[model samples]
Target: MIALLIRDLRLALRAGGGFGLGLAFFLILAVLVPLGVGPEPATLALIAPGILWVGALLACLLSLDRIFALDFEDGSLDLLATAPVPLEAVVTIKALAHWLTTGLPLVLISPVLGLLLFLPADAYLWLILSLLLGTPALSVIGTFGAALTVGLKRGGLLMSLLVLPLYIPTLVFGAEVVSRGAQGLAVNTPLALLAGITAGAVALLPFASALVLRINLR
Candidate 1:
């Protein structure tokens, strides 16, 4: 499982393997939104949390297909399925690799992006905390979407359709955490909810993803 994790990370870092694509897209979204929305600091600050959350969510989608597509294409997935490592563990590791490559960068870079959006100074910590709690769910849920679509050609659009609805809970709670934090309100409710969603997704989604991958592989 560790070897598989390392291999996936290495693959993601390779050119054309989707390591930087999501980050680039995220940066572009942050840069373009300010240009399009005008320079009013108040207005930018008001929308910053939602915009950042949405950008991170969409950026995650950019690499969802890559989670399984390359391995599926080269027949490596079949080999992994038959290996001693359980498919559930493989699915979990794939999600972890996705988070490390796509989600982690987004979390790290979000503060810089926040500055562009005039995000409230007090909100930065909550923004990072919310993203830290929420992005693992995004990766795990995205892995499920990828597993569902792995055997189909041109599945990226379909995977996005399938995954977006599932992403709503995480997006809502995550954005709410930052919004309330920025307002100096109690964030405990939404923060707890976001953390719960991530915990549940990480704990349970890998089994479902593995089952879906098995079905698709067959």
Candidate 2:
């Protein structure tokens, strides 16, 4: 499992732009948002939490296809399926790698982006906390989406379509955590809910993803 995790993380790093692409996308969103939404700090502050969460979610989405596509194409996935490691474990490790590479970067950089949106000072920690807890769910759900579409040549659009609806709950609760914190409202409920979603995804989605991948491979 450790080897698989390292292998995927290394592949993601060495695979040209995959390593930085999501971070770049997040940065670009942060830059373009102010221009598109006008210079009103008040308006920016109002929407800042949602914008950051949405951008991070989309950035994570951008890399979902690559989660399994390279291995599927090169036949490594076939080999893994036959190896001793359980397919569910493989799926879980892949999701973990994706989160480490993509989601973690987005969480680390979001605080800086929040400033550009005039995010309230009090909300920074909440934004970071929300992202830390919520982004794992994105990766796991995205892996399921990827597994479902891995056999298709043109799966990127289809994967996005499949995953976006599933992402709504995470987005709502995650954005709410920060938005409520920014407004000085009680954020405990949303934060707890976001953690629950993440936990549920981590526990249940890997098996579903593995089942989908095995079916696709067969």
Candidate 3:
């Protein structure tokens, strides 16, 4: 299991298709915003948090297909299904590795792009915090969609159809905390809820993802 996790992480990083592509997409979204909304720093500041959150969410979605695609194509997924480790554990490790590779890096880079949006210094910490708390859910839920669509050659639309709606609550509370923090308001409520979503995803998504993976493998 440890080997599978490490190999997948290494492959994702080296392939320039998982975290790498998502990060590039994230950068593009951050850069395009000022162009779309105009160059006013104040206006950028006003939209920075939401822009960052939305961009990160979309970027996370971009790599969902790769989660199980390679494994399925190479027959590793079938081997994985036969492993002594429970399918839920296999799903959990994969999600954790995905988060480590994609979600974590996006959270790390947000503050820098956030500066382009004129995000205040105070909001940076909370924005990063909220992303750190919220993005695991995005990654885990995406894994479930990826698992479900593993055997389908053209399931990208269906993957988004299945997983994007699940992303709404995470996006809402994550943006709310950043907006509130920028306004010097207490962001505890939204931040706590974001944390709750992360916890809930971690606890529940593996079972869901495993079930989907099983169906695909069968």
Candidate 4:
């Protein structure tokens, strides 16, 4: 399981597709925000938190299929099922690898994108911090969505349908943290709520992903 995690992370990093695609999606969203909401700097700042949160959510969506699609196609997934570790452990590792590849870079780069959106100076730190705290849960949740639809021909859309609604609370509180911070208000309430959601997802998603993996492997 650890081996699989290492392999996936190395391949994703070397190929650059994981980070490239996610960042591109994030950048595209950031670029579009001004167009959608008008170019006034104040309006841009007003909406920046929501924009970043939405971009991050969609970026999470964009790379989600890769979590298990390549392995399932190449038969590594099949081999993984027969390995000694628990499927849940394997899924957890895969989720972690996916987060490292697709999410960590996004979190790391979010501040730059936040600046592009005219985000308030005060909120910039919270934006990056919120993503760092919240995005692992996005990957963890995305893995379960990936597992549920790994083998279906039309799974991609279904994966979005399944996982996006689950992302709402994280999105809400994550953006709220930045929004509050921008106004020089109390930020911890929403930030703490976002953390709670992440903890809940991490604790629960692997087991759920494992259940679906078992069903798919059958």
Best by lDDT: 2
Give the poorly placed runs of model 3, Cα more than 4 Å off. none
The local distance difference test score of model 2 is 0.96
What tens digits encode model 2's per-residue C-alpha lDDT throughout 102-213? 9999999999999889999999999999999999999999999999999998999999999999999999999999999999999999999999999999999999999999
lDDT for each of the candidates?
0.95, 0.96, 0.89, 0.89
Candidate 3 residue 83 Cα shift, in angstroms, is 1.4
**Candidate ordering by lDDT (highest first):** 2, 1, 4, 3
Distance from true position, residue 164, model 1, in Å?
0.2
| Clash total of candidate 4 | 0
Segments of candidate 1 deviating more than 4 angstroms: none
What TM-score against the true fold does each predicted structure earn? 0.99, 0.99, 0.96, 0.96
Pairs that clash in candidate 3: none
Minimum summed lDDT over a 10-residue window in model 2 is located at: 9-18
Encode model 1's per-residue lDDT on 64-83: one tens digit a residue.
Answer: 99899989999999999999
lDDT string for model 4 (22-136, tens) is 8888998898888887889999999999889888889989989988888899998888899888999999998898888778888888998888889999998899889998998
Q: How many clashes would you count in candidate 2?
A: 0
Tens digit of lDDT per residue, candidate 3, span 1-218? 89879988888867564557888899999889899999999999999988999999999898888888888899988987887889898888888888888899999889889887899889988998999999899989899889889999788889999888989999999999999999999999999998998899889888888987888788
